[model samples]
Target chain A: MKTAQKNPPAHSVHSVHKTPTNPPDILAPVREMIQACIQCGTCTGSCPNAFAMDISPRGMWRMVIMGEDESITEELFNTKTFSLCSSCYTCTLRCPRGLPLTDAIQALKRIQTRHYPEKAKKNIHFYASFLESVRRHGRVRETEFMTLFFLSMKNPFLPFSFAPLAIRLMAKGKVKPGFPSAGNGALDPIFQKARELEASS
Target chain B: MKNFTHRYFYYPGCSLEGTAKEYDISTRSLMAALEIELTDIPDWNCCGASAAAAQGELLSLALPALNLAKAEAAAQASKSTAAWDILSPCSACYLNLKRAEAETARNPALRARVNAVLAEKDLQYKGGVQSRHLLDVLAKDIGASRVGHAVTNPLSGLQVAPYYGCQCLRPYAVFDDPEIPGTMNPLIRAAGAHVFPWNLSARCCGAAHMNTHPEVGISLVTDILKAAKGADLLVTVCPMCQINLEAYQNRASRLAEEDLHISVLYLPQLLGLAAGIAEEKLGLALNLAAEKDFRFETINEPI
Candidate 1:
């Protein structure tokens, strides 16, 4: 089940104007790499997420080669299959045409994140919030990252769903209730550096 | 051109400089005895691990490009008449460099932007250096035939998971298969250790995710540990993956409500053990596992 973001907008794949005539610089090499694909079904056939893909690896390759990037981009970013991609090189290793499929898809994700920085920003916020806890504490305190993630979300109780598990963890001595460590030097700079890097380009 | 025994350009990321000093230490000591020389990059910078990409996409590529540029310059300065093999002991560093090289090589425009960033430091990368992880260099350069001859101890009966992690194989299919990578397995076996064949061998240990999202990180580590439950030890080739899974294994195991206490050792450490290097000499003391628990004894029988 795909979970919708708090404030939703109704937009379909057709809304975006994606053309191949002159794609972004970051995307050109990707396009060329995808064009090298001979539409061999080997990737789709071997893909662990082939059944789950919005556009199968072959279809994604075809769309990329045709310069129908919006469709490809939408499928990748909006669909669960993208993240489900194991970043495994099974497809690339199997490609007889020597196309770098694994690298191309990951590169595609990086490209999409570049254009729609906000979505990437949101994911980063959720992701980095955890790192902030670790950097501040020397070691990661699960309770802290969970607390921050939930607080940032409109539905605060969403994280509580995992409370029972957390309880079990605490009982097993996997996580300590109190501060795991008493250091904060590396944490601030790590987070600050990450944020600054994100904000720059 | 000056000739040096087994000399290659080295790229050590932030972890080696700070947290994973043991990986840096052991790698240097083990490689030195094997005649593999590590020449660190001058003015080397971060490889932009999991942070750079999350912060912004451009820096993800640019940061690695900076390291690669330094390596290329060093290679040129050395004037060594060998292929430019830029060896990265860290998995994240290796992946980032390979990813940037593959991306820029594919897109000249992106290369231009990256070059613009490189211009700031007055360095230009000509795509000369081949970004290879230390594991690849061990297997490809020093073949199994050579490694077999070097083995002094065989880690027999010890079942180990050859955890490739994500960075070594992702983006660029440089060395091994991402899903079922066994590129390092044969190498381990050559040293006489039993390679534990498992599905999660190439699974993500959340890399930097453990630092950013503890829940996700814990969940990922739990799953990886669960998958690799049968193994005696989890041998890894990446520094970040090593730290996350090994350092955080107990915590992740506790979080998942299990009594999982799998040892995590570096591939080089395992190789060092097989190569007759003592466990203490290989920095096994720094490991979270019982250092004495997994030592391999040399066998008189041919493996």
Candidate 2:
């Protein structure tokens, strides 16, 4: 039922937090966005997986505004709803307050993957595997990517479930399971710098 | 300025090469027919797709910024034309590149941050090049009449639903009204196909959510296909939408208990078919469900 924040109020009814005495450069935008939230529950209600989400979007926004850092981090790790966002931008579009819900959730996801790699392994594994391929070849080598992706999983046999589909695809020549040549040299240094920034940040 | 008249740099993102090979073939074939030469962004990197930004902010901007730098260099190097337009066929790539351009243009702070990271490459994203979706180029630059004029075999009876997956329409209102984009309707009609009113044309087919949460993605795809129930097939721009709808239909059917047999076709392939290109040349035979569900036996005949 394509729903929207029918009539958002002036401010979130949830109590505001006073814990943010100081904010980092990265979190500054998050803080500004936190104030912009209307607590309309539209994001949570509109979320395709709200029932499955451990921390509803409304609850997550409330925690962010309250500066309940520890609780928010725990919720992110335990519920993994931030990881479930498909970047559909439905919440961002529907937000009467115009909060960038997708980016905020992904920012939390970055924090989650950074702090709890073990818990966020599934969420970040493909990302790691994909970047690894891109780093080496500039372009994504699907063959190399698949090998890295499946092997990274504790149970490698899981990929076999999609074998029937893969075979049909191979027959149709949709898949060329081989390492292709890397792309040009333009982005190599930028990628290295990004890696360095990620480590430092 | 993307007044793409004769030629422009094209970024055929990774999915086009792998999962959507038919899209690649059809795109190349159709571009040839249209006399549009797409210089591949030499050695283009992954546009830091749905994955990169989730991990690191700097990585997200820098990845696409590098490609823009390359396209800029190409445009500057060409003395004949000042056209510095980068056309990305994949919706994710198009959105990411456009986001990079807009982000750099809108927020000087973010632009400075991204440029600081790019300094090592002697690169700076000055944000002059125009980014456009391929459909926009075909619609605006190539013009509908020219496209219609090239059509030799009109698909007069084929009932089609144009699917515009999420990434292309969201976050920005670039080419068409995101809500009711008539971008593909004109092209489909030019090819002589029956355009059905598909309500889910702008819906998301769960995107990469299919990877993390298969059930969620499958259910979304089910809804999209179920919405396009009366149509014989669905035509889309994104490789993800096409692959997801075509490959995962049966799973969604089992889960939703509906006969979701709509074969997914790339817009280029349909245009190629209507332009009288052989099915083999345009890679229609490679479409996972097109052969099984589509009634194109007569249309597949080589002109």
Candidate 3:
């Protein structure tokens, strides 16, 4: 009888080392956790936004598992599948293999923002504008955050899309007028420290 | 009054401060009515929600860690030995803080890395703070019996569909069955209201997509409103769900080609009404749906 394969090829195709041209190292942990995925359609089925996604959640995982080649990894990042994930966690809860699929999706987002910034400019700007607001006020000042996002989009007509809702929210006193006052800056230290750590890493 | 003095450290999050101000007001009013003491976590910052996750995991974990650390510091300053229960009314905030707490507790290396970032601000999280959703505290800490006892004006004829949006239930089934959550049923019944049966209780409201991708968000909201056509009011625990369900009814109606105009109110807002708390204190006037669709006198006058 063949001996039990205790540790058959520890670093298989799935365990490719981090490289500039390869998949991001940040996703390695989540990828490892989901290595047991059986190509099941549970995640894709459970995802509420999968209907609108360019690639299904199951297909995203398939790319991650078989993503040893740089081209496959590039294709994974190029798809808008992970961007549409609303962090609903439905897929994570319903996965038969109990994989951290939601986290894996999030890792894809982070990778896109960091590695493929040119492709993810719109989303990157949106999130950056949001974080800039949080960094400044410790809490998001909605109007200012929206202004920054609209400005960063470089599309003057984009604000018109939200004009109806903005008017309604303002009418209800949900959107306060006037510039947001400076916050206590209590979060400055933490934000500064986070930036430093990210830079070093 | 029965001795049910459950104390918690409250984190109302950014939405409660702005768009969902009613949720903040009603949560406080309802908690006070129940004789629950809530100490605000001093200098609590934003939980970063889904936006920060796009930046990096460190920043995502760090933002929530800052709030958790602040809660821990406040707990220590009070010289309390008991484990801290940090209650957040926003589902997104609750999940962010809970995710950080759980991740830090499970992984020592990651904890060290986060602690290193926090140490610059003279803060450190020892995983002492237990982050909880308001629904968890309501269903688990304060039982339905106590809630029922506090109801002075029972919402007898009110048909409420309890909508438990994504974050509070999923990725952590601490208080109720994640997939088929029934925690709010007892609370609705306790308020003397009929629980409207629906399968979309735990549906995704498309969250921030309401802004980023309105079409997709409106489509999801349309499905939910279509399912909840018969209900008088859809009660929600998360501010995100409340806004998404309430703010987009007009567009959702147009999309579905039906008048899916159900009044959306926070769970605490409904509970506060049943408890005889004044509408002003509950900020019921602030609710967009309540302003148009809900009738306060219907529930106020005894059936």
> Which has the greatest TM-score?
3
Interface RMSD of the candidates, in order: 9.4, 4.8, 5.1
What local lDDT score does residue A73 receive in model 1, on the 0 to 100 scale? 49
Candidate order by decreasing lDDT = 3, 2, 1
**Model 3: residues with Cα > 4 Å off, grouped in runs:** A1-30, A180-185, A199-201, B1-6, B81-83, B291-303
Better of 2 and 3 by DockQ: 3
lDDT of 2 at A90: 72
What tens-digit string does per-residue lDDT give for candidate 2 at B21-55? 88888988888887778888876778988778977
- lDDT winner between candidates 1 and 2: 2
| Candidate 2 chain B: worst-modelled 10 consecutive residues by lDDT | B294-303
Best model per lDDT:
3
Residue-level lDDT of model 3, residues B99-176, one tens digit each, is 999999999999998999899888999987789999999999898999999999998988899999989998988898
- Please give the lDDT score at residue A199 for candidate 1: 61
List the TM values for chain B, per candidate.
Answer: 0.89, 0.93, 0.95
lDDT at residue A12 of model 3 (Cα atoms): 62
